[model samples]
Target: MKRPLVSAAVVATMLSSAVATQTYADDALVVSSKIDTEGSVLGQMILQRLSAAGLEVEDRLQLGGTSIVREALLNGEIDIYPEYTGNGAFFHDMTDSPVWHDAQQAYDTVKAKDAELGLEWLTPASANNTYAISVRGDVARENGLETLEDMASFINDGGDYKLAASTDFVESAFALPAFEAAYGFSLDDDDLLVLSGGNTAATMRAAAQQTSGVNSAMTYGTDGGLQALDLVVMTDTKGVQPVYQPAPVIRRAALDNHPEIAAALAPVFESLSLETLQRLNGDVAVNGLDPAKVAADYLATLED
Candidate 1:
């Protein structure tokens, strides 16, 4: 079933009412976030679990980019949502230095910055959202190409491999340029197929489905399909990409009011290994299950 679209004015009204209700209820938190099929899978899970914990959840959601969510948090329109640490480093303008390798350092940097915005970043789930490169299982098995170091040798020795990458990968400071500089393998401009905006999942699935264009793609490290399509992630033997973990960020007022909220959701973080998260992502993103239900069921499993 589709959720009704709530206008900005309606959300504003709801926020006001929720704020007033908070005085009486004392456990209310307004979660504002994107409603896209991709983001909703993750957002709805957190929202649903938080609501089930007796927090009065006002889902005054919207379909927008991360910038919109960030602005909403700053304006006090929303109290909490899941956020990525690298997004804080790059998009939020914290530091130019690559700090993704150190999870604790990244958390500290983001926490310090969020304080300026009157926000607090809770402990992050154990998932790194770093950029990755993947090759078809067959190619990997046949050539023993399992890591970026292997791929660099293959490419340098004139291996017949092509790559499909997003425009972002082509331009991101941490994506392709870093790979080239670290490995000393320059792709013939013709060897790369640039997708206007699609990321790794689309390219990976397409590669699995067909043996045309490119044999590899640029992807996120924790993408669910890497194993599903029998694709092998070429290890960043040189360690180029940065770490990105998903975390809950809340308004300071909300945290102060309901200090136990983090503990309630802490179990979800405790069991979220890379493989576990990938299976969950496959269930919601690939198999098309309701994210809220998946999140709820997974949370329930934690109690078992």
Candidate 2:
């Protein structure tokens, strides 16, 4: 057979055009979340939505902590993940700034800053997974401790109790020290049972079981174990910790291809509120259901 020779430039142009019309190696969006039940559910929600919208997706939910997932997105190993607004302050070394205290300010700062890194923040879920102080039901009832201020008053009056906290809580600027300074209470090393940072389930369990004379535990606002363990989560009435509302962040490259991604997810994220999140967390963290099932159920409800 005889064939006409094609120029190298013509071949290159044809290949490029094919990729533009169809897709290339990086076409399918890789979705991921942090190693927590809430992150898993949120990640599953996004993954499901993309699937529903007829976009090809790769699932890598619950990959690791904030840093690991953020790095993966930067390196293009993954295309998108869920992230908190307050974490932007820490990731960019702007923790001292007041932007983290206000939700809109925090979102604006992260969206603007991360844009430089080829990342895009989507509409954030209304739920804030900020750390909280939860106490045993009996302790909270007897002491009338519903807020950090009440805890402070009890502390001043010589209440005997200890706190279960992670090393991060003891050291992070947005944690114990911030609470102490905000509410005028102090927790000496004598008052804390510090464990290494990871899943907070263990720390919350310690308070639930009253281990090591501990009646207080550091918890996320949506921790399902709070009610199941007969623990009462104290209100952060003083706004000590930074707001941690989560937003779906995508690699700009992915968004460029699947521009409908943000529109597909906006309503779903908007429907997530604090109480709704707690209920969802309880379904997985307490009832022991699969995150995928929980996410699927929630998505079904969205249909009706």
Distance (Å) between predicted and true CA of 148, model 1? Answer: 2.0
Model 2, range 106-125, lDDT digits (tens) per residue? 89999999999999999998
Poorest 10 consecutive residues by lDDT, candidate 1: 1-10
The C-alpha stretches of model 1 lying farther than 4 A from their native spots are 1-27, 36-38, 61-63, 142-145, 157-159, 171-173
For 87-179, candidate 1 gives per-residue lDDT tens digits of 766545544676655777777888887898789988787776578888888888889997898988888988888888888888877679899
TM-score of each prediction: 0.80, 0.79
Error of 2 at 133 (Å): 1.0
Each prediction's total of clashing residue pairs, residues at least 3 apart in sequence or on different chains, is 1, 0
| Clashing residue pairs for model 2 | none
Give the residue spans of candidate 2 off by over 4 A: 1-26, 138-144, 157-161, 171-174, 187-199
Best by lDDT: 2
